[model samples]
Target: MTTLYLLGSAAPPVLEIASVIEGAQKRGYDVCLGLTPSAARWLEPQLTDLEQLTGHPVRSEYKAPTGADVWPRADVALFAPATFNSLNSWALGLTSSFVVGFAAEAIGKGIPLVTMPCVNAAYAQHRALDRSIAELRGMGVSVLYGPDGFEPNQPGERRPEGYPWHLALDAVARRTA
Candidate 1:
């Protein structure tokens, strides 16, 4: 099966990651779930099930330098609900977290990477956001944002279900096909 590295940040949409994993599986991907540390904690209760669903361990931190990798190499990648922090950090090549680190390296590894951010309008207004988006685009990453992808909600408001998860999957489909 084609392998997909499905990564998420601490955004609310991460609560529904099971459905997204199922969606990727249905599309013929062997999903490997990676999360930011905060997200791992939030989904701790469901980690075992997620690992069972993907047939691999849920990873949030890097392993020892001498250890072998636990999951298979990814053929494609999707980072949905990438918070303002994740998006900028990835673009700037900061590998502090496992997800961001893998994403930064994936760019150089020639992985087909796609990202959809879920920031509220308030955080979206930051100047760094635009630059990050542009930088990732220049690196050949498929960033589904603005009117074409995720539309930011009001700062204090959230509708995690409204995140365009399918858009990211569809982009994955295009690349994998």
Candidate 2:
């Protein structure tokens, strides 16, 4: 069974991520989730549902029940709807939160890291963000999607219609099969 780490972001995408988690469970993967603080607010109820669906805890902080122990090796680490702040923080090696810490540790261990960033056009077009994204790519992190051909400053405007949970799970399936 593939161990999936569901890293979270903020709202609008929270609903999408819940759908993704449900999809992932239907596909029969062992899913474990971690959410950023902002993402947490939008996903509390959904988190409990995810835990019930996956039969494991949905972690949001390093103090979570599964933290600081030797974790079961994951097949992939996916960050859907990755916020600009979380992306920048991860790109710069900051691990103040559980999601960030897990991503950092996974990267260091050479786990396949995939990110689908959700951000406004102005932030997405910033030079610093560009550099950070480039750096993450250089480190072999695969970015699944981002804003394109969308108006500036509109939150969650450029997200794809369906969540790419299957794509992420397929990647893991191929690797572990």
> Number of the top candidate by TM-score?
1
Candidate 2: regions farther than 4 A off? 64-71, 146-153, 156-177
Candidate 2 per-residue lDDT over residues 66-164, each given as its tens digit:
646534668787776677788888989988888888887888898888776766766867787778778888888876554321123455464354444
Q: Which stretches of candidate 1 lie over 4 Å from their true place?
A: none
Model 2 reaches what TM-score against the true structure?
A: 0.81
Model 2: which residue pairs collide? none
lDDT of 1 by residue, 1-177 (tens): 999999999999999999999998998899999999999999999999999999999999999999899999899999987999999999999899999999999999999999999899998889999999999999999999987899989987877567888999999998778
The local lDDT score (0 to 100) that residue 113 gets in candidate 1 is 95
Model 2 clash tally? 0
